[model samples]
Target: MESHIAFGYSFQAVGKGSCSTWGTGHFSTFDNYLYDFSGTCNYIFATVCDEITPDFNIQFRRGQNKKITRIIIELGPSVITVENVGIIGMRRMRTSSALKGPVKIVPPKADVGH
Candidate 1:
């Protein structure tokens, strides 16, 4: 299992059907990248971080704990994962769902036709 430090909490992404969440603000979240049949092991959860910073990522990778079995079973042996595929930045997006947060909005000035 690899540990990641995001928001403030440290989490370890372990074996098959395992998961983790490490983030501070609204734009923070993680999505499953599994490609084959949807995970039959259905479960949902949420976690809160004590602090948040702009920079957060895989804290440190240890040799023995760096097994790739979980992700391999998730995406199948033949698939490849794209860069930043499962990470979410919802808080930074401009949409109705974003309207409920602390984000500030200034309506666009109407265009005056010549």
Candidate 2:
């Protein structure tokens, strides 16, 4: 549950089981921290920002037996301010099928305009 904010965005440590139940509000910030619990949970999603700055570093740690699905970083009605962009994990898959793969970092354009 350790979390912090970087460049006006919040980044927190999310457990494996916690990703499935996360809401859009959880991704309102420009950064996020994900921890893979021994590969128990294999999927993670997030809401992205409208503008992606260079300072946005989306960090992730995969446990022994876990894999990530869709890292949905949604763009909101505001500009995304950051200094770096990154994704740390296994392979990525286009679809979700309970299988293990890399971390899919999605940069979805914000539905609403800022």
Candidate 3:
């Protein structure tokens, strides 16, 4: 089942076998909770809600692995807040240099009174 929240949406799977996938736009959020007993496959993908303006977040987790990956992509001059990523199996999670700030956006002009 999928649920929509104020800042974003959430998905929960609780059963012996179940799998699902979802996708959303920018300025949107996603929270997923899964409880699998008989082995299931789930996938999700989210993109910028607005074109030429990137502001989105992707959060996912797997019960067996207890792994969660949160990726935040912000565009058009803004600040992003990413936190609360717990330790993973004695190994600390770190961000690589490749992950940087927002990039410039150039929106196309629209024809008016044509």
- Each candidate's root-mean-square deviation in Å? 18.8, 13.5, 13.6
Query: Candidate 3 — what's its lDDT?
Result: 0.32
Q: How many backbone clashes are present in model 3?
A: 3
Report the lDDT tens digits of candidate 3 across residue range 15-78: 3222233223322223434433222223233434554544432333333433223433232344
Q: Pairs clashing in candidate 1?
A: none
Q: Which regions of candidate 1 are displaced past 4 Å? A: 23-114
Shift in Å, residue 62, candidate 3: 7.7
> Which candidate gets the maximum TM-score versus the true structure?
3
Report residue 39 deviation for candidate 2 (angstroms).
3.8
> In candidate 2, residue 40 scores what lDDT?
30
Better by TM-score, candidate 3 or 2: 3
lDDT by candidate, in order shown? 0.25, 0.31, 0.32
Q: TM-score of model 2 relative to the true fold?
A: 0.20
Task: Give one digit per residue, the lDDT tens place, for model 1 in 1-114.
Answer: 444344322232333222342221111233554222222232222222332421112321112322111111111122222111132232222333211112111122324772
TM-score of each: 0.18, 0.20, 0.24
Worst 10 residues of 2 by lDDT: 16-25
Deviation (Å) of 66 in candidate 3: 4.0
